[model samples]
Target: TIPACNANYLPEGISEHCPIKVTFVEEGLNTNKLFQFCNVWAKHPLFIDKVQAAWVKLLMVLLKKELKVLNTQFFRNVVAEANDDRMALYLAQNKLQADPMNMTLQRRREGEILEVQKYIIYGRDVLTT
Candidate 1:
């Protein structure tokens, strides 16, 4: 016999060593179950409306989760690129100071350094537009 379930709980098993009890499945790949609505419930006028409301709520929750993942990735990539550029310029400047005549460090023009700084300081705000 199937036990009662709510929004976040599902009955999994019962203890066999002593008094029989129901253990709910809190997490696992196959823990989520399907919605089972009896056809007889259609006789109620509010049944359809209730189902629609439930489905809409579920869709909203799923959409929010997806948006969170996308936002996290966007921030991660944007910030990582910005940090990389800043680190590159800083490292080159440090090396140039150590070896004042290094040709590679001298190749990094002042304009290029300014461009990198501008991108990190201002271009990162491009997401607002």
Candidate 2:
């Protein structure tokens, strides 16, 4: 939960209004969820406090590790699946060359190649961070 106060100065005798309240709820523990939560909290004004900043940094580190593991697994799975399809296409392309219907398979293989390229770019961005 976060509390935001409207502290604009008024006349000499004006009274301040009650602070606004904001609440965040997390349904379960996951790297992405935790990372987003930490990111939001870290940007809050109160995060300038030393203790809060330290805790947020700690959470960021842990989330980074978790996300890295998840990304690695996802990349590996995509590569393996793409390789399998490529092998299958290699063996079948010649037999199906005369058949116009096989264009779909070729398109699928191209899509898989693009997916691999995207993953590689994403991995590099993550690592450089």
Task: Please give the CA lDDT of all the candidate structures.
Answer: 0.58, 0.51
CA error at residue 49 for candidate 1, angstroms: 40
lDDT tens digits, residue span 35-116, model 2: 3445666687776796777899999999979876875677664545545544544444434445637877557545544543
Q: What is the C-alpha RMSD of each candidate to the true structure, in Å?
A: 18.7, 22.3
Could you give candidate 1's per-residue lDDT for residues 61-112 as a string of tens digits? 9997887688567756554555565556556665666786878666763434
**Candidate 2: Cα lDDT at 67:** 74
lDDT of 1 at 129: 14
* Candidate 1 wrongly placed segments (more than 4 Å): 1-76, 109-115, 118-129
Model 1 quality (TM-score): 0.33
The residue pairs found clashing in candidate 2 are none
> How does residue 113 of candidate 2 score in lDDT?
46
Please give the range of 10 consecutive residues that has the lowest summed lDDT in model 2.
Answer: 9-18
Worst 10 residues of 1 by lDDT: 9-18
